[model samples]
Target: MRRLYGHDAVDIEVATDTQRSRVADVLLTHPITQRRVAFEVQYAQLSVAEWRDRHESYVQQGIIDVWLWGHTRIRRARSEYALEPYRLDDVQDELRKAGMRVTFINPESSQLAIAVNRFGRTYSLASEREVDLVAFELESIRLSDQGVRSDAIDPFVTAAREREAALRERELEAQEHAEARAAIEAARAKKASARDLERARAAREQFASMPARVDARSGVVRPSVTMPARVLCRQCGKPLDATLAEFGVHLGPCRWEQERLL
Candidate 1:
């Protein structure tokens, strides 16, 4: 299409409002093959006037073959078998007069076997085997399998599109899962940080509540000395039980104060 295969397969600069043949949704041109394949995808039924108008535009634009992918709607309607039958007849007549060749790629087993729609005064002669997009996608396919058949292009492009779409969907799902995990980890980290803060607060409170003794001699202070927790002095950087306070030295002084005393 113009969006994906613009510079590679399609020519966008060649467009105009008056000509109305400006550009197609997808156009694949091979310089060596001298082949220009164009597509007109139809997701819904096209009335008689719209069908003929579009056919003429494709032919005049020097496109090799035209593919009309009829969307599945009203499965059992006559329009399901053929679209704008009368209009197709008129368009074919005009194209034949202009010596233009047209082929129809209808996605039906019966149509494939017959390969022609000779509706009584209602349609033009066109190959009928439509490209089953879904089956063709799910099935293993090769580009070289169809030798110069325009019909093959429809299915090939369809499969390529479906595969690409599925891959993108999976990638999006994986990204979503990764984002979810990051959010969960962030929340967990915050919870753990809160718990650590609570433990720190409780520790500070217990240390403040515990009784301490300061040795006036060594400037060493000891907390409520215990076997394990708080066994180190809160001040003077000395073991609680081994501090000046435990040694009953009342006139302890740090080096800074000792120098002043000297």
Candidate 2:
């Protein structure tokens, strides 16, 4: 096998004379270091039958990693022999349980699934998404003009994190909805988010009838509208511009004023 794969490791495939000898169909050894590897191949047609027949060959070698490969669909589908150290079906089953879209489809009767979120795109299983965000926020420092750490970095950061944690605890305790942000920019963010959400919902509602475009990444920014831009008209349907000319009061506007706000 080593001769075929052209690895620097040397492979020795041997049969055991004694019943106690651990058997490796292809025992790979690092040429110079003499590191030994006992590789086993089990087909979809034959797995434990093969392993049980070969297990006694490696017992004297102590611990040997078995690489199970080449199994048939009929052979790989059954879990009656599952609790074995290596099985393709176990990996495939767990991936299905995790609700991931990907599965093993190779012809070798091999299935290996490490879930999408578990694939280590970022942090470990213990600290997954936002671990970096939390770490960055925790380590945030405000440098002063004098090249010293500003007082804001200390008390302000600590207070903000404590406040956030407290909010999360309260939200969890109450079994409430998503916790809203409390940052100074939160009000503007909420307004922008609401506008975006409304736009998406409306677009989705009329998507089938909407015209197809070339290249497709185009949008328009809506002008800002706040309570200050509008005043209630007591009589007419026109939007009363907040014109405080006569006195400090916004009386209202007549119908011919053009813009309307009810």
Task: Work out the TM-score per prediction.
Answer: 0.32, 0.26
RMSD to truth, every model: 19.5, 26.9
Q: How many residue-pair clashes does candidate 2 contain?
A: 12
Highest lDDT against the true fold, candidate: 1
Model 1 C-alpha lDDT per residue in residues 15-51, reported as the tens digit of each score: 4235565556545665445466655545565665776
- Against the reference, the lDDT scores of all candidates come to 0.45, 0.37
How well is each residue in 12-69 modelled by candidate 2, as lDDT tens digits?
5554345535555665554444445555554444444444445444545543444433
Provide the global lDDT of candidate 2 against the true structure.
Answer: 0.37
**TM-score of candidate 2 relative to the true fold:** 0.26
User: In candidate 2, what residue range of length 10 has the lowest lDDT sum?
Assistant: 125-134
